[model samples]
Target: MKLKLTLVLTIVSLSLFAQTKYSNEFMNIGVDAAALGMSNAVSSTTSDVNAGYWNPSGLINVEDNQLALMHSSYFANIANYDYAAFAMPIDDRSTIGISLIRFAVDDILDTTQLIDDQGNVNYDRISLFSTADYGFTFSYARKLPVQGLNYGINAKVIRRVIGDFANSWGFGFDAGIQFQTENNWKFGIMARDITTTFNSWSYDEESFARIQNAIEGQNQELPESSEITIPKLQIGVSKSYLFHYDYSFKTALDLNVRFEQNNDIISTSFASINPALGFEFGYVDMIFLRTGVGNFQNELQIDNSESLSFQPSFGVGFKYKGIHVDYAFTDIGDQSVALYSNVFSLKLDFSAFR
Candidate 1:
């Protein structure tokens, strides 16, 4: 039965990747700390508490109690993301977690204008508006000793709030499988964002009724309706090597190929390949330095310029007793200077039950 399920998941992932019109909404909200470290490639390893966001199957390797928090400052004055997660082992072979992620787009200038009776120039005042996106996740992982494998699933409730305009709600799921060979080879697979698109992005008529009445009273124009769709579908694989040396060194490489199906005019289905590599060196696992490269692609042809850019990232981590602290920096390149596309994240981990 497990084999059959895995095969089905593989087929569905491939099919989704081949589809066009990918949505880009909710893309920036899924960010996490470990992901910030390796350019968002924490899909396989069970080394940290952030695994709940990347590959839940990794939870099988977790012991005792775990708590983690991650925050990211994104491009623009738009929004910032904050993530928190907690995991605990139910047994030697089972683990469970709960996580929350919030994306907030701060004060934005509201451009709606109120004109005078004669259609003459009138004073305009900027009103502040903002958007908030949030998600709640419940995850579970269990190990199958017979196959030397571990599997997990995550169920989520997603919500979005855009000022006084409209709000949306949706549901989604993620699944993952991981295996280790007797020779110490590790392999993993994950399917993310599997669910239907949100269709509840509706506004309160009462909020706009006042404006509508004013415009109607003056025989002016009315506002048009607008909607947004959240993107879905991601599949990834990862592998790692553990080298036995005087000082232990571990290296890992992960690849994720994502596809979005556009459902609205603002989104277009596109394909992207993200590859990440990280190296960890330490003695007795006290301190470590990690660096990686990701998002390598061909020339990106924009309006008037052709640019080739890839995001590179670096991080450092420290472990004391059962507490861990990690910091990472990611570069967004200069293709669009105004975008200010750089990210920095910090994570704190604590093992309460261990």
Candidate 2:
């Protein structure tokens, strides 16, 4: 009987909702299909508008004004997730970006009316509503005086809504840096929620009263009654190679660290690390194929055994005259436990139109 302070369990199934474990879990669902296909291992190689979410420092690579759009559905199409972003160069050495992400489950049954005051079940009394979460990011990246080095930062706002029952707002900050060697090897580090995001929640007890009576004494609450996000860090290395001047490939690896001893593949009393590997192959820089394996976990079985599991993802992309279309099939979260998602994304280079 956990505190049902929110009807968030539905979307939260993806992350095993825990206040201190992974509070803003929705944002962790990678945005770009190309990146998601790579199991979110693009911290060092991301170079476009999508970088606004991946590693803003990478936005310094944007060569033109760009726009991106993406959409995905989870759990048999019960939840819808969408993302959009825009980025542009402010100067030869600086760039700015903005992005929005929305995750929602709509048409949820409102069972408060299922039984009337007469204690009789009514067949047509059910209605529907929705629960949604949104993330807004504003980013800035600038080349450091140090050659081949760049840095970026993000200001984020978060909004959560539970139909008309409750809502919350929060704010946080992130920073990152990317460095490239003359030999073309790349490295990056991103610090998320460096200041610890805190949420201010307000409940509509009157509205929620609808469900309160239906399940009285069932929902428990946290003893301390406050929500805050912990910080996370991602470090990566990547390199690209070309063969015959017509074929090319890039390989990347990222280590994600969170300050807690958890179920990650590599865990200790003080922290945990999850490693992701991504590879991309391109034919003449127009058609691309990508694959990745990550989200490793150890699950305890009913028979008292431990099983290792990992999620594998694949994606394809087509680029023509600065318009990019990408598709991906992947598992999000350890929800990879069984569910997989199909994602599509489109990117446009405004310079092409110019």
Candidate 3:
């Protein structure tokens, strides 16, 4: 019976993985420390509080209480987003963390119109519509002494709100492993979004009813209610090197490949390549600079025919005493300038772990 229960759970988990769709909105929200670390290609192994989002396995490095906060004013004002996380060690072998990420779109002009039963326009009102997506994550990490490896898992509660049509529930999980080697050589692997769809999303019944009544005369079939897929699969690796310098200069590089299937039920598949490099210079790890690029295929372009292009990014970070700050800017290319022109983010870190 125990074996049977395990098998059932495994099957359910895999089914959920296949059903969830991908959303670019989830990709654009940047984690704080990662934005400073060249978008976190090496994140699967790095020990930091933000690991709750990037790679929970890295949390094993936390030795004390930690707090992190981040905010991004995206696209010069289309929306505002923020992230916060806290972590602490439970014992020598384990660590725990909690994180929250939120994105808000404001002042959307509601163009919905109202009409009378006689088929005459009764009135038009300009109202505001807003959309938000958030997730709460719990993470745990442990270190294996024999293998010199760290492993971790993160469970998340996902929520989405769009004006009156809000989908308020779903769950997902991420797992990762990192190996620490001699001479500063590190290797890491991670699998993200391995769970069932967060299917709590549904239209406001009242809104659907209104639309149904409006179309009653046209004899149109009511639209089928359905849920959206959150983009679900990501696997990647990363590496870093320390420079032999008086100022403690370090260079790091990472490469990540992401895949998605059943994109909006139109494209069959899609892929992305992300490469980043960063340099740190200073005695106290106080100053840093980073740059990276990402490529997408034509099928993934905004208009569907434009050839896929590269997006370039740059960022900077600083550290003083017990506080850390970071920022990054990304250019999404001319074809997508109107919608994603440029994205920027800022993050702050504070921790009692020393």
Candidate lDDT values, in order:
0.60, 0.86, 0.59
Sort by TM-score, top down from the best? 2, 3, 1
Report how far residue 297 has shifted in candidate 3, in Å. 3.4
Off by over 4 Å in 2: 1-18, 220-225, 333-337
The parts of candidate 3 lying over 4 Å away from their true place are: 1-20, 23-28, 33-37, 113-125, 211-239, 248-255, 258-283, 296-308, 332-354
Q: Write the per-residue lDDT of candidate 2 for residues 1-354, one digit (tens) a residue.
A: 222323335334312223555677898888999998888899999889998898999999999999999999998898999999999999999999999999998887666667899899785986677889999999999999999999999999999887776777989999999999998999999999999988776666676566556565633331222468999999999999999999999999999999998888999999899999999999998999999998888888899999888889999999999899999999865643668889999999998899
Residues 1-354, candidate 3: write the lDDT tens digits: 443343233223222322334432453345774454354554544678877777788888887778888776666776677788899899999999999888876765433334455657443643556767787889999998766688999888777666673345667777887776666566666667655344454556664354345334531233223444443333444444555543554455555545544222123457544554544444546677666555333445566555544455667777775666666665544235643423333333444233
TM-score of each: 0.74, 0.93, 0.75
**Clashing residue pairs, backbone N/CA/C < 3 A, model 1:** 21-261, 21-262, 21-269, 22-260, 22-261, 22-262, 22-269, 23-261
TM-score winner between candidates 1 and 2: 2
**Where is the poorest 10-residue window by lDDT in model 2?**
10-19
Model 1, 305-324: lDDT tens digits are 54555666777777677667
Q: What TM-score number comes out for model 2?
A: 0.93
Best by lDDT: 2
The root-mean-square deviation over C-alpha atoms between each candidate and the true structure, in angstroms, is 10.8, 3.5, 10.0
